[model samples]
Target: MMTVNEVSKLTGVSIRALQYYDKIGLLHPAEYTEAGYRLYDDTALERLQQILLFRELEFSLKEIQSILQSPDFDRDRALDQQICLLTLKKEHIENLITFARGLKQVGGMNMDFSAFDTAKMDEYATKAKEKWQHTNAYQEYTQKNKGRSKDAEEALARGVMLIFSDFGKCKDGDPALPEAQALVKRLQAYISENYYQCTPEILQTLGAMYGAGGEFTENIDKAGGEGTAKFVERAISIYCK
Candidate 1:
């Protein structure tokens, strides 16, 4: 596990910015020490890499958070897109360098602005953003959350965690127990009512994420207890079947 200071030094992201990312739910550390210092694992670092790449593409923090949190988010696919965008940026820069060098050699006005055009890069970025942001679930979530107050949004988040807290209470018991199954039902209903439709497929994906050892797991375990996320994932798996 790496401390927050280590992460800052390694990634060159300011400690303050990391703190802000935590505050805004952009990037959460893997865990916290008893003394309340943040600790991160490889998974968190990988997430930070994704954030940095998106930032290089000029994506806003909000956009990055949304893309990362999306149920449809695919790390491999995102990396592929980031690589393509970076290559395009590199090509644009090389073109500009060549253009500048030619102008200097000629020592006269060359008025060739073609090197500055970024239409290809811009088009690719727009399409990528649309793919990340316009998923049917995301569109529904956006429509449902339109005009919601910040406090209301937070309250909804708290409501979801409270369900996880209930899951924590039964972590030691059989996940197929009636109470556990009931909690799964409640969770599905709550998500369908608030965020997006909690289809069995989506819920299964979310269950995997809950135990996947990152922010969602950390937050769920924080709400419940250690192993709570995994227990919930098991329960959800049974419920889905």
Candidate 2:
């Protein structure tokens, strides 16, 4: 068994946070020593690891507590989902960075599409196609992106993120405006071009996910500035409707 101070140092979670978790019954130590110290066994340490994972995914402590206490909680399934979501986050961050770099190269008013080439993108899309080939939701994407060129794929990612930045500039604009609708159309077409054929149903789901407070949401927010994710969701809602 390890003491609370030891667990704090090992896990980088503050002793105060751990104490509060114990107080709220979120995490309980394995035993109490004669000196009134908290002693956590290996099982407790493992549980704490799971809690940190959920926290990293932006789950509120209450939500995490409920999830852990639920009879249906599956650690493996949860970890898998988190892994997929975080991977998407990393991809979005990279795409957003590429978008920003493009702006620096071509000036903010006009984007030089050539800055993002096709070869790298095509390869990435090919990899995505392979990854999702067995999934029915991405059949169209898989088939369309097969043997596609790298330049086309790269431009699609850059173009989409740039549009997101434009959307940030339109925070006050109506989602139903002609320009906004047009942008959403570009978004749909871009996805269909570079990744999958994003049907209205899929686009709507993506809009919601962009506002869902994970990496996807953060990516859009970063590209479009504050409130961009929700704006995109609202715009997509109208566009898809």
Candidate 3:
């Protein structure tokens, strides 16, 4: 048996979090010394390892507790399921990267169905539940573009990204310049043509989101360079003003 401090050092689980786990009945000391110090056995350490694994996957503490305490909990089976889910997520990310590269190569002029179909893009979007897909812009886009052919959608996507690519090259330029504002205009028009009726208000919101980071920031920065996202935001400000 090991004391709480010893367990903390061995497992790297903070003493405070361990104490909270013990208080919440999620993990209790296996024994107690005469002086009332908590003592954990090897079995307890093993359980703590499992808890950490679940936490890494973003499961809530309460959910992790409940699942571990479930009558039918099967550790081996749970590990198998986690492996499968992680593998699927990996595949989804890899496919998106490949599709993005292909789009960049298309130059926004012609549709490329060499490796991916339009339906496939839609299918992946649904499965990934990307951040943009949750936005009003996406909703408006889908609604406006409804009933459009897959080929049309692919062409529109390439056109939109081409504008973004231009923005990527002007990270240090003034957003108020004709070139920057012109690209912003093209971006708005392209959206209106394909996805939704992008008013000035909608375009402004998109500008904020682009610089706000995550996939949008990453994509924009990839097209232009480091500050390209902020450049787009500034240009949108000028255009929408």
Best by TM-score: 1
Total clashing residue pairs per candidate?
A: 0, 6, 2
Best by lDDT: 1
lDDT of 2 by residue, 137-169 (tens): 445554554564546645655787898998888
Which ten contiguous residues of candidate 2 have the minimum total lDDT? 128-137
lDDT of 3 by residue, 17-111 (tens): 99999876577777688998999876688778768766645566765665553322446755655565566566657776887877789757535
Evaluated against the true structure, the overall lDDT of model 1 is: 0.88
Q: How does each model score on TM-score? A: 0.84, 0.44, 0.42
Pick the winner on lDDT between candidates 2 and 3: 2
Cα deviation in Å at residue 83, candidate 3?
Answer: 27
Q: lDDT tens string, model 1, 32-118?
A: 889999998887898899999888777889778667766787878888999999899999999999999999899989987999999
TM-score of 3: 0.42
Off by over 4 Å in 2: 1-133, 143-155
Order candidates by TM-score, high to low: 1, 2, 3
- After TM-score superposition, the amount by which residue 173's alpha carbon in candidate 2 deviates from its true location, in angstroms, is 1.8
